[model samples]
Target chain A: MRIRSTLTFVVAAVAALGIVTPAAHADSTPTVRELLDKCDNGTDSCVFHPSSRTEFGGARHQVGRNANNCSTVNQNESIAWSDTTGGSNSIGITITAEYKFGEEFSVAVSATYEHTWTWSHTVTRTDTLTTPPWSVGQIFHAPQMQRVTGTYELHFGKKFYGHYYWYVNNFSATGPEDTDDAVTFFTRAMTGDERNRCPKSVSTAKEFVSTESTPAQPALVASVRPGD
Target chain B: MRRTVATLIALVAGLAICTPATASAAPATHCTLRLETGVVTCGARLAAVTNNDVIIGRVFDDQNYGGSSFTITGSHPCKNGNGRDFGVQLAKYGWANRISSLQAWGNCWLNLYSGPNYNGDHDGEFKADTPYVGPLMDKRTQSIGFD
Candidate 1:
């Protein structure tokens, strides 16, 4: 009886001193989604930095419609993404064009394209409008462009059996769902006069991801043209 | 009478010791990141978690990301001989020859080798998440590349 009591006392003492450590098993690892929720609940193991606004001008790639004093003109524009890494990337940019001639000359393109290397999905928009026979040298204007917005997650790993931490990398911006408008040009029939004529405008917008966790990601850029 | 007393004592001591061990059998780390502020928090977490900065790839010691893990991160994606050349030498990081599954993100594809420095038996071009890297390649990864 005395020996048993001594052993029990020794065990309790060791337990109190915290000399015993439990074995760790990795069979029930937590999913990434679960961890994200923990962060949302304001756990300190995760470091979060709010995203800042990044506004960029979409370079305008213009398609010119020459005036035919004889009649109205019909125009059609088609766009698509021919190459990409697929839909893991959900962000897109919208393009539009407005003519300085009048608000009636305003063209809003709801067609949004993903930021990818090759363009595909032939989206064609057609419009027909009358032009004043005497009107020449008409210029179309491009209004303000849209901004990119979103958040990114950075998971940092340590050399432990089953341990990791993460940071919230955010990007915030407020702008129209659609971006830059297109402009049409008119030329008067005159000899040695190029003033009424505007060369084609090709605008390219490059999207970048800014995070304190990594270098600027320029690979997310896409180039668009009026007819291409 | 003596045997019964001894057995009772052993049972009581055994329960006292085994209780905490059972309670902490699984020491999984749980973490999360806030969308608005970009802050992260963790629960039932580890004492330390080092940031690798930019994440390009991740390796798991078990299938379906259910074990110890090592994250592969760099300034840029894995490139050929030049460019960013983001490659991880597992042995150098104390994870040599110990990988069973993996994933690639940040515009990257993965290439695995059984030996370090792009040597040994090779497999992959894994552009998608792979739950299992095959028996021949399981836990045989000595080097990794992010392309």
Candidate 2:
């Protein structure tokens, strides 16, 4: 009896103070803020690129093959940072559009060599295309290992009540962002004669892509409001 | 006794070398739809495939086109250039980011992306048989746009 009287007095006092306390229900509707918070906890219907809770630091590697003799070397080196969030997005907006990443960066022809025999002697030529941020005079010798650091970004999206919410979280990291090995060669340069004596032409290819691109749950829901 | 042991070792090594290796698994549920006859063929192999048929592309679960595979066929043949395009929603078919290798057909250029709706990290165009989709794109393919 005494505890009940105290509870009633407290309720009366709270009501007199004009503070409206939300009533608790077994099946209460979550607000927009609550839904967004669920995305942060990675427990709701949200999709994360790379992963919802992990750091990506893997590198993409390519190794040049051995040449027989009088060979040509051609290669395409590329590193791309893209979003992999997918689901039934009813809001008609792209998940990637909502979550931005670095970009699709590629080196069309990173290295090239040509060996031609005119009438008199064999003609040999080699060239390496260096784009911005790449140190000039960096050559990728034969039988060399070329590696490009992976890029990282955080992108996520969620669908709630026929609407969608997405965020990039303002967090991104490039393989070379804080490392000296943005693009590095593991082996030493081959001599001109050795390069010319390569057994066969060497062509190498490189690529970068998402580590994980699946959502934990589907992002589709009915169009009903909370209490309706 | 030593000679017998050596012969047994050699026999075991020869068996290991001559035994046929198991091929990688391909997607078992995916099928091919022939646009001309509307015939659906499941577990169709694209090896030695000709260009006369209306083919969209083939996605592999393993690199070098090994393992399980699936073919995509559309209503009409893919255009020579980029006239009309067919975008495969990989997630709808439960194939998002599961492709390690791919090949284009029907004179179409297979364009890969890491995201849905063809957004993010476009992996250029591939008209040749790509045994491996490079270090970056391997297993990162989410969608393929044929044009």
Candidate 3:
């Protein structure tokens, strides 16, 4: 009966052209906590930057002010800073989030950093008449040497879900006329007991798959004849 | 002259009975271990502990652990070489899973991990009086060092 109505109109036109193929809706990819919640919801596809600083004697010592906000996603959050003139600073901050899924498959990275600072300077001298022999205005109070440094870096590029780079560096120094408090509140309570023996957080996740799929190209008009 | 005062009274009676029996037989040179409650304490220094507790040596303080578990032998009680350095603070101060348990005395050797910096996930290498049970470090230990 007309070859059963032409094989039911050629299988309903190849099932309506595989239901309007567009690579079958591009297989909907995007996971890794939804691209780390779209880079922690800052949107615009994710990329953040933060900076801070405070100085003394050379001026520009605001000491504080650097809100810092990202709210966590692929995880990396915690920022802090404290200062008290001539020297006495405590800073511990770490923010890291790196993700690369597909395109070449898996890649997830994280790094954390923390630092404490203390610097002091104070000096006043004069009592010259051949080594403390006589006084022409004798003043003494000396203890000077202060230095503090901090740095954090994050760099992720090229389709691990696209580009990103972040860097933060903090600094402070004192000497020559000295200061006395270069880290002491009992040495910041012994660096808070060595930051309580480190390792607060560092995250990771991974996955990679591609085990062959390209064997359906041998059917290009392989055997069909009807009235021509 | 009366035999030199009888040889100085037998060398001051053998130095006062060998100096309090060697200072009551060794007291603290460093020791603080808490491998999940298998407690151990010894300090001639370092005692101010509370937050989970773990600090081995090299000038110590912050010590807490009075009982709930204790046993590490290789000669029952004698420390030196900075008592094999050790320290722990699994949570608070930024939180993270916290599980711990470990024991190693004498020649001392320990280096276990799960994270907290020694580059996590190694979980091995213990010596002498061994004993490291599961949760394989529950809460996932951050870092533990000794040699």
Candidate 4:
């Protein structure tokens, strides 16, 4: 007589079956935080530290602007623009959305780039900050975004799951350098669920997932994890 | 006959005190599986899993992660081919491993590298406890090297 069988397997998600009350919408367009760590209801809800933010303000919905110089000298020094003596810097970028029941998605950052001397008598100029408009690479210029954050869900014998990342900073004048350009984008999660109904829409593949390379670079970005 | 030899020794000591004693029923633990890179031989799906050595599978990593391979199997601690070749050299360049609270299937993760960027993630389960619903995430990456 050996009849012992127990199965309490609950890998439930779909946003945990209902409840995605993101009411407020006076219209700003850019509040997408479809997480998936362990809470699925239908469109893929199980992304724990899911996040979203598109601030750098652009002075009000412009989402575009630039100026940079994290100037720290001696990467082997060279700074010679006619004996230096000019300064100017400013920074502020915001588009916050807190809700995983509240918030801790920290990022109120500021910026500063210095070297403002628009000159007038004859002509004197300088502009050393290459091209990059507050990039995560301009988030692919908004291809409907299923990214720009991290973590996603859905896997096992059918396919799909994921882990994307960010800690982008450029267009800098100050405040956005935990250090070195940050990048990572592992993936799979995108199965079902939709915050309540039509929260944009993007179901990660339900699968038999396997990984090993594809721009999945991340050790510590966004908040810092290298040497400090 | 001495009361029938004491009733045949009290019926042989009550049939040896109603014999019944045995123990040893625990053995079925294997892991280090790889999917997308290939392999899902759970035929009848292991009869719909309660625990058939835990081999749930899936594969599709290729948006810069191309085709790779992996394996680790049973009581995994280490040296099962050196922990399955160090999880195939951390999925051969990208890396992945974030399995949590999985007494059964509430949280799960494993990807060597699929594309763009990766690592540090957990809680996106599958295989029978199925909750994701239907499919959608396959944008096309393919990064084994040489862009």
Better of 3 and 4 by DockQ: 4
DockQ of each: 0.01, 0.01, 0.00, 0.03
In model 4, the runs with Cα more than 4 Å from the true position are: A1-8, A11-97, A101-149, A153-175, A179-228, B1-105, B108-147
Q: What is the TM-score of chain B in candidate 2?
A: 0.65
Per-residue lDDT over A97-128 for candidate 4, one digit per residue giving the tens place of the 0 to 100 score = 32221111121111011111111111122323
Candidate 2: Cα lDDT at B66: 49
What is candidate 3's DockQ?
0.00
Better candidate number, 1 or 2, judged by DockQ: 1
What does DockQ come to for candidate 2? 0.01
Considering only the true interface residues, what is the Cα RMSD of candidate 2 after superposition? Answer: 32.4
lDDT per model vs. reference: 0.36, 0.35, 0.26, 0.20
In order of appearance, the predictions have TM-scores of: 0.29, 0.30, 0.17, 0.18
Worst 10 residues of 2 chain A by lDDT: A9-18
TM-score of chain B for predicted candidate 1: 0.61
Chain A of candidate 2 compared with the true chain A, TM-score? 0.19
Q: Model 3, range A94-210, lDDT digits (tens) per residue?
A: 212232111001111000001222232232222221111000111122233323232221222222323222222231123222233222110001123332332333111011121
Candidates 2 and 4 compared by lDDT, better number: 2
Question: How much DockQ does model 1 earn?
Answer: 0.01
Worst 10 residues of 3 chain A by lDDT: A103-112
Residue-wise C-alpha lDDT for candidate 3, range B25-88, written one tens digit per residue? 4442323333334344544432233322222211111111111121222211112233423333
